[model samples]
Target: MEIVLKKGTFLVFLCVAILASAQISVKRLNDPAIVAQHKRMTFESWGDWRPYPKYFLGIQTNFAYATVWGMWAPKINRDYKDGDDIRPLKSTGEQNLRFAQLKFQEEEVKKIKAASDTIYKRSVQDLAHWTSATVDADPLWLLYYKRMLKPITEFPDNPQNFMEWRLKDQQTFETLNSTGTLKRLQEELDLIKEKYTWSRTMDMPRGKRFIMFHETLIRWRIFVQELRRYNNRTTLLLDYRSILNSHLPTALPTQWTPTSDKGIVQNVMQQYKHKY
Candidate 1:
């Protein structure tokens, strides 16, 4: 009798479990709203969040002191919003940025602040002026930097040009809308570039140029490259991966992320480009 009773109870538990699972499946399949919510939640739940990129950003903020702000041209143009251009920033990533900016403790900021304090040291200070003077003197990087950050409308074509994607002014006259002229835009880029005149040191090599600053940028570059690959893979899976899906299709990847303390993303991307 005990054996029979045990069997009956087990059977009832199995039925209940199966029924619950079936109900979940049915609800998800039948309801479009449920599917949309599921997608939204899935979009937000990327892994690796607890510590945030606070340490990373702090390093970049300091590094920007010695680094130049410039534009990056790549597989996509910044003007349109289709194809490989604009990747959706997951909602969780947005939240992480907010949290990092807000609740950092006193000690955390103090540490990063110390590194930056080294900017006033006599050796580094002289070097800073010397370096800035040299870059400021260069019209080529200046021109490149100027036109680089400006919209792709200013560029003739993508780095790997396919005549079809070209945005010649005569062809797309209606699409042209400039809030500022090229001269004004160049001034704006130059002014923004001037803001990073000082940087913090992370053990800072005795005479190293841009030290922690350049290294941090390298790390960010790698990070962004990896994120781009992931974005591309995910995009391929979506039904709409074409340019029409974008609210503002861009041919450029404006921002950057780095990969390591030892090297910049430029170095890494070069190493990996064969595979990319």
Candidate 2:
């Protein structure tokens, strides 16, 4: 009698559970809003499950001395909105260029500061070691002492002049590298042409020659490179901001989630998938 009663109760509970599930299915089928909200929520949840890049702005800020001030680009299909027009992924070279430029700027700035410090230090050494007549005769040493001793901001009132100085310096190096310019500069000299070469200019003592060709040109090149780099950075930053502001259509259509259909509608489509 006890066994019979337990079997009956179990049957009743199974019936009630089946009925509850049926009621839920019916309500979902009748209510389109519920289905839509479910799909939207599912898609959003999928984004939460998405993996982050191995390295990003947060990594740079926390681990490196550098920080990105510009808008980080988002992958189109991954970071989607209701009608966002997706843009194609940039070419590998173009994609890498962003980080490369940032690193280049950081290193370039460090090099400039180091060069400035060295100039001041060398000037101090020269003043101590050399006679007053010799020290006074060397105008470049005096200039370095004066310039590096002051803060960079205090020394320059005109930005345009500073840029011009950079351009003038670049022109000097290019001119020196031009054909029929440096008779000693041989084509097969086995020197690394891209980077700065001290082998050629190091032995040339710190006088008018060194000031005109080496010190002046190098400083100017730094200024020009960094100035152009920052200007380019400004353009990229503004463009990215504009992209964020606009709700324009992206390149790709929004990907629908698994539940993005009305009730068993997706099941019907799946049945035809193999045949198609």
C-alpha lDDT of all candidate models, in order: 0.40, 0.43
lDDT of 1 at 226: 47
Model 2, runs deviating above 4 Å: 1-137, 144-215, 218-222, 232-234, 237-241, 251-276
TM-scores, all candidates, are: 0.18, 0.19
Q: How close is candidate 1 to the true structure, as a TM-score?
A: 0.18
Candidate 2, pairs of clashing residues:
84-250, 85-249, 85-250, 85-251, 86-250, 86-251
Candidate 2 lDDT over 32-129, as tens digits, reads 54454344443332122212234576453322112211124344433453233222222333435666788999999999999999999998776544
Off by over 4 Å in 1: 1-208, 239-276
What is the lDDT, from 0 to 100, of the residue 133 in candidate 1? 47
Alpha-carbon RMSD, each predicted model: 46.4, 49.1
